[model samples]
Target: MDCHPRGRGRGRGGRGNRNEESRDVRLSKSLSYALRHGANKMGLQMNSDGFVFVEELLAHQQFRSFSLEDVERVVATNDKQRFKLCNHPEDGRLQIRANQGHSVKVTDLELRAVALDDPDYPREAVHGSYMKHWPSIRSQGISRMNRTHIHLAPGLPGEGGVISGMRQSCDLAVYIDVAKAMSDGIQFFWSENGVLLTPGDAAGMLAPCYFSQAQRLKPSPCEIELH
Candidate 1:
């Protein structure tokens, strides 16, 4: 559910063809791509809740060689808990969807709305980025870009309940003023996997005014000028 896709490890000691581990990684990435961003492009009939039939998905060219067990393995073994598998409400057919970080529109994906004073609200809401983009971010605030919502981590990586959302390689961290933003009509939602999501203001931008603090977190911790 991080902004940037995380890299997967290739299997070691493979002669020519990819090993089981390598194949699993490939299937995971493919599933992420299809479920998160390209279901429509891949010709999969995704519902408004962002779910597609597992059988239909497997029928796609990229997944033709894969079986149901392979998908179950990827979903079960994924460290980030990115995918969710369930049965269709109308019928009993199995379906799958991404937990969060969707670029394509998904109207109802089981996200819980968070209030500023609510206990479910994240104690720390941070957006991660790189130093190279700091200047632009300082001026323009945080843009959701092509994503439907801006992703935020509840806490830094390795902290409790901080499994995904922000990329580990990010050098800069922008802390958001959740109370202030909510008071001003900005909305926040919490995903099942503990990712904080915001649609931002009307223009889909979290303005600099709502940023409580900015800091360089990698190499060494250092404060950055927000004003």
Candidate 2:
């Protein structure tokens, strides 16, 4: 997977990813939570800061493969009000000025978030709820986000910002779904090149008995279907 890193993120012509050296650490964090805690169990809900709290507990890197771009797209669609934060959708295109400069072409921002559902990402809780369970998720792994308290970003609720937070700064909100890991898990691959499909839709959901029984979360992986 080209685990070798290129060092800290540098602002320039192009930065494909953030801290590449942190890949294994990040993936380990993600896998640890999904297997041990069942992040999906956390009843997913969007906070005003533009994050969806998946109380079940998740790893730091669950959404590693997922781009900040995905987060931006979801906010625009999931919460209609978020559009106010955007430049203005025209011809179904999300056009916005960037901090670096130049405009990035965002097509169907709504579909972006929807596509992330299947990236096998860790559940994300708000600041308060995440902070309350932060100890467990980071140390042992396990959280009940519904009952946990968290903090809000205090930033404008923009879907793009949400993504930029992760992919760029890799910071938007604090998530605590790191269920105590210590075990191997499953990996889903496409039948072909995987260019035609992704685990991003309802089908991407990875719900399981352990997720429900141990985590007490919902949206069983069974609810989703395979192509």
Winner by TM-score: 1
Q: Pairs clashing in candidate 1? A: none
At residue 111, candidate 1 shows an lDDT of 96
66-91: candidate 2 lDDT, tens digit per residue? 33333233223321112212222233
List the RMSD of every prediction in angstroms: 5.2, 19.1
Worst 10 residues of 2 by lDDT: 189-198
Candidate 1 lDDT, tens digit per residue, 1-227?
A: 21222223323333244577788889989998999999989899999989989999999999998878777777876878888888776686888899998899999898999987797676558999999999999999999999899999877777886988888899999999888889999999988788899999999999998888899997998999997
Clash count, candidate 2: 22
Over 4 Å off, model 1: 1-18
TM-score of each: 0.88, 0.17
Clashes of 1: 0
